[model samples]
Target: MHKNLSRWREGEQAGRRYAFTAPSPTRYPWQWYWDSCFIAIVRSRWDRERARRELESLLAVAEDGFIGHIAFWGRPLDLERAVRYNVVRRRDLTTRTIQPPLLAYAWRIAVGDPAAEPGIAAHHRWLGGHRDLDGDGLLWLLQPDESGLDASPKFDHVWGPRAQGRRRFPLLIRRNRALGFDLRRVADAGGPVVCEVLTNVAWSLSRQACGEPSTTPALVARLWDERTGRFVDEARGAVHRPLPPERVPFTWDTLAPLALPDLPEEIGRRLVEETLLSERFWPGVPLPSVALDDPAHTSRDHYWGLRRYWRGPSWANAAWLAWQGVRRLGYRAEADDMARRLGETVVREGLREYYEARTGAGMGARDFGWTALALEMLSPRAGSGSGSA
Candidate 1:
């Protein structure tokens, strides 16, 4: 625990432009939207002021309630030259698309309920106005990065080479405009138009926490696959179709709706009994990003040889969210056991970006922020509340 705390303190960065926690100093050197939220939630356990500042720095740069997925700290020209996707590049050293809306949940946890109100309202308004691309009451995820599950198989068909081109780029821009954005969208759109489960669940959890009406019903109607008894990624265009069990495997992201405390009993039961506790996801470590039986599962090697960035890696943040859901649904022993195993793995392997599902081998960036943050979740002082779904 002392080692983890020391690593976290070392990752803290304060600059003229931003004061926040970077997920990893060597790997991720910028302020990421959802990462900061998780960091702040954990930081609240020991340092309230730093926790508040972690979120406030991100909110300080929000435009019309849309916080960039990542805020770069250096000069604009240097960033502009390096960033290939125009959609993510901004004049003020930030990305354009927002990450999962976990800020509201984080703010309520780190700051007080009253202090979180304005940002919550503004962010909710912005999402409703600019992200509900098809007027389906649920928001659309433009890219896999926006959903925070970058290389999941759910988006495999959507982001393939065939989806890229000049024609699709303009349609994407038009779609953004129709959805209420004033700026021009510059990236080519070939990725699937998904009403991502995590994004919607996060939004719903945040709304409910803020005393706003829940959007779970709308989300269920859009993504719930009655045939599979799970939430599958629903594509907007006819470019994709539902796959058979042998070909397309269920991923942890599909079960993200379980994180919602108010999830319907029947749906939640199916998730816990039929999936999470089953051999599919509960193999050994608890919650892997991809199920072991899934055809797309890859336990060795990281994405692009950099690090295991979410593909078949077990993440503490995701596991902690699942633990909260399990505890909320009365699986006290199961949740506690899972939490204990996670803490043990982190302690043994040291703080890392993620871990190998079965072996618990530490992977990715070392001295990671969220890896250290997981210790706080395991501590007795941690509150029983929903974090990033």
Candidate 2:
């Protein structure tokens, strides 16, 4: 246990120590949501006190429970200034719109650690309720970026008015299609407007909070089209009138199956297999993102340049979701393998805000939530041995 504790300690300290970075060539950094989740998970194993501290540190700095996406050496970052760089916040402009909800998930895992219980409960209570943007009982994505398919053309119509005209990169039309990103509307040549990912994940959390069978299944099933291999927006339908077959499926599209609790075994297998074949889904790399594969898949530099925010890239957050689906289907080895690769990539790449889909390289802000989650997964203490799924 001590050796495991040591490993946990090392992992937690690594996050705490590396948590801050220079905002740019000169500014300092602070703990982000992704980093906190990683730090909290690791801390829960060896030192519950540290886990609570991690959340406390965040709360002390947080304004109204909505933590900022980035900070400079413990000071909140001024993201508005970074808009020129295409760094987006949730609609609120306070935090990065789309972080993996691993914090809630992690808290659930660590609740047994008495020191962690209060903090975990507090955070959960903060996130437990619903925000009915569409008035559909399902939560709405506060920001398009929260969907992790940022600036993808699919939102040109869906979210254009609300996002204030943030559209997909012009170059993504060809590359996204080529990479197999076509199946998902988020990669539409036009840009996706509405975000379903955040809303769905929120529903999942809501179910967890209420301690009831998931209602997401009914919502997901409503979106599923027998005609198409992917799910469609219940409100807008497909972005393209005669939607391209390849454009309909994205990594989030695959999540529909996992969210649904009791589908026929064959039906579940088919969705997974389809996702595997979708070139845009795997992108020739182990990492999974909103886009599967497209010719103009985001390159690390392209993303940093805001040329292809969500057109294509292996996002750690999406990888976490994909891993969940893989595990649900008894693909434990594959899931763990992915967790290791993603975690190693974050450390090796010295990650920035995001990454390039064409190549598994980091881009955007350094040590952003996606990459940070990857690091936490690599922690020896962060497995089923420590808690439940």
Candidate 3:
């Protein structure tokens, strides 16, 4: 396992060095905040000075308190023309869309210290600027598709215009009609349900920003499904269940009350334990966006970039996030067990963007975000009890 891990880490470092040169000597490609955050997390384990530079670099790219989404080599991707769909344009500069407010949490984990006063204050101010608290107080996400890499079909609906200029990938679905693999026909397929990790993260951040009492009524209402005793994807409305059932068990959903200091403890605990760990939800792969039980699990036969579909694959980021929340609530034994399981699986199967839920087989970009996440978790410098961040 150690040998495999070392080889994988070398591959990841090489990929990063080659694929990601600072777009410019001075500027950054779109603000790539979450990506930068993750890079910093891993880099901190290797080189604290460079990790610090990565954060400072992100700050360098911020404009009007928000990070732009697309930065070319090091400069911002040029958005000189009106954004168009299916048309090749000049420089693509549509960076307003945001991912999760994971920078602060990830920074705390990576830096291994409480953020300084200015650093903490700056992040909070930026969070406030980005948060949309209308009269009703519901935190409306202007562009929900900013949670990079969930690979949902419905993203075109919510973020069509902003996402237009970006490269688009074909979504292929295959169904076994009790005959064989038929790529032509797929049943019960529609646009993807909302699977935004950042929106959920925003809910978590809001609680942290507000002193960790209770989730605001608006955020709670967005996620609440009184009938199921669980949070559903907000964009899908009440009709659609949250895809990736395994993640639903993640303490993020339960931590909502703790973060906001709202909701009944019993309700949160029940949802955390029963539904999240239920056989129907927990896939053999362990980290699926859509659980093993979902009908759509096998429908998407291929992945973006001609790669295989990881939409249903178990992912390290989701697992690490779950580990953090679980341990925070003092579920130490459970945390250790989960970390060992997820880490061992990634090490054994080889790191891919995701893993097959039923088979534990790995697939997707070889050294992608999920794979890098696993490496970061295994890095000894990631800190004790810091299963994954």
Candidate 4:
């Protein structure tokens, strides 16, 4: 564990452009929002000053409370590539959409108070206004990539063949970015627009941590499906109903709301009993990104084709969040079991981007930042206690 943590420390970049942990030295090459959040959480356990610096660097680039999904090292070619691929526009160095509002949540944990930070309060305020797209108090994902699940089946249909087809990739990227990278605009473009469950939950948790009012009540009223015992994605715009259960993509992201420490008892209990402990999600390596039974579920060896990315890999970051949520809800035994399993996977597979859900085989970038973060979080010094929700 100490060796893995050393790799993460060695991976840190400091001095000018940004003092943040890169997700990986090779594949990722830049600082990502949520990745930094998790990284800070782990860093706080040992080095509070460095953890705080990591977040402060992110806020340094914030524009009107909107932190771009990723911050590059500002090379001319990188900037040109981002604009050409529509990953980011000329006006901003970051991507078109924001990542999960997890910075505040991590801030409160790393520092004593989230609002104590220079720009955090403003960012929190920015989210309360701009991100509530439909005014239902639930946040919407402007693009599938913003959800951080990327190529998950939840977005397979919404992104369509353009997302998978190499020929159409550039066109799809431009179209999504041109639409302001917003779900409402996608709806306007005759594409499916979903009020993502995980993004809103992360937003609400950030609000709570920052001493802002709770948005979970409004989110529950808006997205929780009492009949289904799960939080379902609601379509944006005039369709004010949760999508059908069959239509809703069952993935680890769908259950992310479970991580909220203050989640209502009834809602959280139903989620634990019906979904988290069920055969669909709790079996095999456990908490597979896509349920094992889902037709879209893919194993690590199968990731080479159109069905790659978040289709079925068990991401340590996702598992860490879920473990924190479960522990917060007083399920210490279950949470500890999950943490142990994830720690073992990292030890056996090395610090990779993610692991195959069932086999625990490492995949994607090795020495991955977030995977190392997870190991640190589960380390003895970090303790098994829950984090700020």
Show how many residue pairs clash in every candidate, following the order shown. 1, 39, 25, 0
Candidate 4 contains a number of clashing pairs equal to: 0
What is the per-residue lDDT of model 1 for residues 1-389, given as tens digits with 9 covering 90 to 100?
Answer: 43343323222233334577767876676677888888887877788988887887777677778787877654242543343332433455566677888887778777877234576688788888877776666877665557887656656666543222222433443455444433212123333466788889888877776777778888888778777887776655434454653355577876778778777878887888888899988865756988888787787654333322455878887887766777777787878788888888988998877888999998878888876656655764444733332
Query: Considering every candidate listed, which one attains the maximal TM-score?
Result: 4
- Flag regions of model 2 displaced more than 4 Å: 1-31, 42-47, 56-102, 111-130, 133-136, 161-195, 209-213, 232-253, 256-267, 290-292, 300-308, 336-355, 365-389
Go through the candidates in order and give each one's C-alpha lDDT. 0.68, 0.45, 0.45, 0.70
TM-score of 3: 0.64
lDDT of 4 by residue, 211-309 (tens): 778888887888787876777666553332334766666787757877776678777767776777788877645458888888878774343343357
For model 4, which pairs clash? none
- Candidates by lDDT, descending order: 4, 1, 2, 3
Distance from true location, Cα of 361 in model 4, Å: 0.8
Q: Which candidate is the best by lDDT?
A: 4
lDDT (10s digit) by residue, model 3, range 118-149: 55456556645444433333333433334544
RMSD after CA superposition, every candidate: 4.7, 9.1, 10.4, 3.7
Candidate number with the higher TM-score (1 or 4) = 4
